[model samples]
Target: MLFGKKKDKVHFNPGNRDDGSHEQEIDKDYVEEEVNKIEEDDVEVVLNNEENIDKKFSGNNTLSKYVELGRIMISMLKDVKNGNYKNIPWFTIATIVMALLYVLNPMDIVPDFIPGLGYIDDVAVLTMGVGWIESDLHRYLDWRMENDMGI
Candidate 1:
């Protein structure tokens, strides 16, 4: 009982079923529940750990492709925090936060210590989050360009 309350472990199934058996995809309901729990402090934690997250992406071949998207999400969150961007929906912000949190967590669905396929779940979560907020992300990109905000 030294570490306060125990955090609930949530698993994200990467759906890597090469066999003929059906596998459940990443649980959207679980993700939504986590997103709903996002608070200002959570946003700050992600923003503060941005460099660490970037290092993880840069060091991994599979996660490298998502570095740009991760940066964009962080940028969007920064803008939202600064009150410079008001066009984004709360859902988009929450989703971005949730994805970043997942990426930052090394002991997630797939532990980051595993070689070869450690970051697969992280990639899956990032891809899923981007898909959900693609339009809002695009709009944010456009706004950034129009307002001379560097990516």
Candidate 2:
């Protein structure tokens, strides 16, 4: 009661077979939802907040890297939405949008207001996300340069 509501626990058995074979359970907290449930207004709010978050970190040398990554992702989001780029899968866009929302979200694993440590988690999330879609992002960048869209 002191720490707040407990998170719902979810489990997965990666090695489990359809025939009900023995397997190890992976225990992790899970959040259930669909992207369609996220409102357009929330997306816009996250987009707008990006600028403020950037300004907050601009003065910090280390946090600047995280801020720049956020900018690049936002730019890609814009290009994708404007139809300036194509061949990108919907799930990729969804994942990027979700990451954007996560970075801008104030209530995360660590609160964003805590001077030095707050953004570590944000950066980690962004880093993992970038790693996850690095190939897609590279393809986008190559396409942008080839088509003169980067200019």
Candidate 3:
């Protein structure tokens, strides 16, 4: 409706002609609808691939580091969720969740099923996340040490 009156049908030119009289006029609504449809489909694909990445990669040579990162991520999330890690910003929690989600996603920067290189992207993303909240993670670690909350 933002485009004012609607035409019953509109013709689209494949390309610009030399005369330039028949220039393409794309409907904004049509473009927007197509983009939204594509995005929705992509989200569905991502959701379908969300599963346990650890189980798939647990036996991998490079999995130890990822498993440790997973433990740290889980601990951080639990602390935040249980109110043990108070005053944390919502964006921090969101970032952690996004990293975890990426790890769980089978199709990411590099597909997780690839032999010998599947977890490279996962490590990169998780490491970036660890760096992003370095100070917060340190604070939580210190708190745990002070409170004697081992494990």
For all predicted structures, in order, the TM-scores are 0.81, 0.66, 0.61
lDDT of 2 by residue, 1-151 (tens): 2112122322222233333311112111121132223444554565677677567557679777767767776777677656676666554555466567767677787798887877766665565556546788888778878877642
151 Cα displacement, candidate 3 (Å): 2.3
User: What lDDT would each prediction earn against the true structure?
Assistant: 0.77, 0.57, 0.54
Better of 1 and 2 by TM-score: 1
Best by lDDT: 1
RMSD of each: 7.7, 10.6, 15.7
lDDT per residue (tens digit) for residues 1-151 in model 3 = 2112122332223243333221123232342233223322333333344335446546776577777666665675666545676755444454455566667778976898887777777766666556556677788778879888974
- Candidate 1: the clashing residue pairs are none
Write down the worst ten-residue block by lDDT for model 3: 1-10
